[model samples]
Target: MAMDTPFDEFLKEWSDNIDKVRTGAGLLSKIRDADVDVGTTPKTLIERRDKVELFRYDPIAERSVDTPVLIVYGLIGRYTMADLQPDRSLVRSLLAKGIDLWLIDWGQPGRGERWLTIDDYVDDYIDEAVERICAETGHEKITLLGICEGGVFTTCYAALHPRRVKNLVLTITPIDFHADVDDPALHRGFLNVWIRSLEASDIDLMVDALGVIPGEFMSSVFSLMTPMRSIAKYNVDLIDTVDDRDKLMNFLRMEKWLADRPDHPGSAGRQWLHDLYQENKLIKGEFALSGRKVDLGAVKMPILNVFALDDHIVPPNCSKALGQKAGSKDYTEIPLPGGHVGLFVSSRSQGGLTKNIADWLTARDG
Candidate 1:
């Protein structure tokens, strides 16, 4: 083929630019029309109180489980992201797979509850919720699926009651926060340099005023870790998929989840940063919550460590390393190709993470 003239090249470039602009405009239109689903799986809020709310996801077809699975979400985002939409929800997929679900919804905390700690959130709230689940399900043991920071809580829960947790699953969890001190993803060593000043400045005051950690603040932190990717990558993609409704809905649902900020209780937020991130206490087994020391070695339940290859928040090493430290004979790790958030939303991971979860649970009826 003969090479095109410079004028022809200029025309092609102009046409591509126009297409991008049109695509972006169409995307914004669809985004505004779509119904954002920040609500979680089909469940009713059975329990609600200050800084804590519990939900029950009714089994799709009469649950056959001798044990119920409770999903613990991270402090960063709302729980419903797992069940973003009916079609693309992790909770919905689990329901279809016959895994009875229970979710912990820590609704926006109030000023009165601003002093809550990880100890309070995990021990007073989560521990009580676990008991409630046991009473409701009539099962002495329950399966735990903890994602991100929630996994840290679940680890403590399992350690406290080794026999109570039949099977334990940790997804995109950062047990070894100190893994890569120099790696920007974990922010283990370097983050501390800024935390003291940030906490002493407007950021701390901002949380104090709001009573919980703001989603916007957390999002900004995530952005700083990967400035170009978080800031520019999405806008560029938005311009290319304006007319694709399904793609647009996916984008909007995610954007909604991203914006639906959850404020972290001040006390809990401070302890988390100081103890876990700054001191790296979890991996060293020096962490204590609820007046008792937490040891990962005590987590002897059958463990499944699921991690995403591209997870910037909780790197693969952070999650995959759980299996080795838990000292569980039946420990397993499932590595999928996606990021921290993508693990819940990515199409490719849906089949693998979803099916594997059911099979893994059913296979181990401890």
Candidate 2:
């Protein structure tokens, strides 16, 4: 009844091609492992045997900029997204640009770490990391570049201890959770639906079963936001790019990073949902990490608020309004023409945004 001849031929060819690609990927992984061990650096292999489990990627090595910088990644994903590739990595770019960069890796959380709270992370852990970097570098203050929820955390830190911050770079960061309901991404119901479901079901049991939050579950959230492209269309396009060596390698790397989700500590995740989302306390200046109140208006250092114009996670009005709230005399705004993730990943952004940040660092260093 159907066109069996052409369909059957196509199916057979597709299966053969899949097998070939599988073999090729296996070889590529081997060559990649053999040629370069990117993780085997002096700055990496962090000693996290203490009370907290963390990793570091010091791109500057021994040398450092006059203005030191520490990058804080978001909560949901691993820090590798910033260093997704050997070629266009943000760490590599900043290092080449002569900015001393120290990246903190909040390692995958185990079941034991489920009770870790926001107060524990920011006041105790991140503060200790900051002190260590400062003590080692001999700089009283360090530039902090925080992305996504990391930006939110950095904001709190800056407000709490203004004297220890040199420059603050907040990117695609959501501050004003009390956004208009029309904005589907910012609407409470949007996140609440999935978040509530996770809580209602034995998601804790699922998490315990998986040990860490499964990448597939995290990936499903991103897919659900754009059901058409992520679920079906992306794989269709991957078929065409399979022939391009460089593109395929980049694809694989991005996919690998995207598949790797950070295990959000139960306490921290619960706090995020309650204080940040439902209560909307962060922007209201009602949030307190410890005894100190988190008031963004207390941030006195020079601020560079970077936001993607098209970012769905952090809307334009929300991210752009930081310049008004921040107490910095030298405040700037840069709205990149990309999505939340694309602000760092887009080829066009790498060309301009990286240089702009480098130039800013250079100008202020002296």
Q: Write the per-residue lDDT of candidate 2 for residues 63-123, one digit (tens) a residue.
A: 4357778888866887776776666667777777767777777777766777777787777
lDDT of 1 by residue, 1-366 (tens): 343898888888778878877876865665443365556456888787666788888778655455789999977678877888877789988888778889998876656677788888777788888888898878888999998889888988899777678889888888877664445554332334455335444656665678767667777876787677776757677665655767777778887887777777777887777777767788888998876888889988889889888776676766666766786888988999887788988888877898888888988864
Candidate 2 global TM-score: 0.81
Task: Show model 2 residue runs off by greater than 4 Å.
Answer: 1-42, 45-64, 180-216
What TM-score does prediction 1 earn?
A: 0.88
Which candidate gets the maximum lDDT versus the true structure? Answer: 1
Q: Ten residues in a row with the worst lDDT in model 1?
A: 187-196
TM-score of each: 0.88, 0.81
Q: Note the Cα lDDT for every prediction shown.
A: 0.77, 0.70
